[model samples]
Target: MTTSSEPRTEPRTEPHTELLRPDGSPVRVLVVDDESSLTELLSMALRYEGWEIRTAADGAGAVAAARAFRPDAVVLDVMLPDMHGLTVLGRLRRELPDVPVLFLTVKDAVEDRIAGLTAGGDDYVTKPFSLEEVVARLRGLIRRSGAAARRSESVLAVGDLTLDEDSHEVARGGDSIHLTATEFELLRYLMRNPRRVLSKAQILDRVWSYDFGGQANVVELYISYLRRKIDAGRSPMIHTRRGAGYLIKPAEAAAA
Candidate 1:
């Protein structure tokens, strides 16, 4: 197996739409790999998509974690120190029969891919693959399996402003607004909690997936960027609460 000299820290330009379980909780995923580095990298990437992630290092751990995590999806490594990944998949299926599984194989042979699929894996990605591809594949699998619903299941609206999570489209007062991936995630976080103050700490944890220490100014910078696109030449919907944090509400509502 080969590792990238420099792994990507940010996801490629794709819809940052959030997916959730039928109960409106974050979608759960299990990642089984003997490599700690690979598991950590995969977990961070998946969390940025707003999905909860659990990792197991071997076939036995994978099966145990699956039963407890009840993951909507699984990313199983084809090679494990303890047992074959196919064996882990078999046990997982016997317990949670319908969960989607995406195999991670170091081999690129056609037969290997077919074997995984034939063994009930929903999809497969070889090593040296892009993190974006894995995320995209899992998103497709979860959606197709009926395990989770995209935010597109319902439009998030705060007054005249509307954001479609599924299409990654935003509009304010009937006019379309464009946002970068980071900007979109920040906006979605604020919109999801309308009229409620969210501190910089919360925003950093939720949107960036890491604490910035004394460098929380990144939040201010992105909030300014969002203001230009979302509030420019209009009655403002996004508001700041002085030392508190930020909030988004209808202009009229804020006026009241």
Candidate 2:
């Protein structure tokens, strides 16, 4: 037997970031689901992975947490107390549209899956989701969003107008447009989901970061802001639907 004369040393593994951010801090995440146990489990798992995590039980809470956390990503459940996941996504698309959302729910119906994606969710992991899979998907979404953020300009263009989320700046052709912080975020969401019809409720929830509790008129005010700077005396790029919602697109205007 060899004599025991060695210092006990714990093996070290290569360092890895749980949440990768250019800021060099762990990425933040929000988990919105009604299942308390699952939410806690996910929270623990994410924390163990070194990512910051927050939880919400209802749609309202989800919206608030998302806005406050400004999470790098969100894990959402479809059946929420106040609203459905689709509605939440609609709101997010209006405010924090580019922030990737990963949906979690027991609803495995194909239609539900399609609906979530159609509403702008980045990915969907049905209930009974594995921790490993959740982590993988979260990483994938964060990576994609981060890459998008780094594009030479976080500016998305259509026709002669461009909306830059990173800089909170808008430009028409070559002229820079000024917008308030909220207005800039709204315009950026619209630009990212170009040509998509977004409802009033969606706009209110996403941009305002909380349900206006029925305030749909805020969209009109901000749209006016965008029009004054981005479309006034120019071709109308942002259009409103009579009974539907608002959409941003190339002037090839259609009912959609």
The most accurate candidate by lDDT is 1
Q: Which segments of candidate 2 are over 4 A away from where they belong?
A: 1-18, 147-256
Per-residue lDDT of model 2, residues 1-256, tens digit only: 3222121223334223333355434468888888787887788666655566889999888888877778888998888888988898887666686889998877678998898888888899876666667877887888878722222435456556666656666777679887888888898677655556788887887778787766678789889888888887777989998898998766543465
Which portions of model 1 show Cα errors greater than 4 Å? 1-11, 153-256
Best by TM-score: 1
- Candidate 2 residue 183 Cα shift, in angstroms, is 51
Where is the poorest 10-residue window by lDDT in model 2? 1-10
Give the CA lDDT, 0 to 100, for residue 95 in model 1: 87
Per-residue lDDT of 138 in model 2: 83
* Candidate 1 lDDT, 35-63, residue by residue in tens: 89889889878876757789999999999
Clashes of each: 0, 0
Error in Å for residue 38 of model 2: 0.5
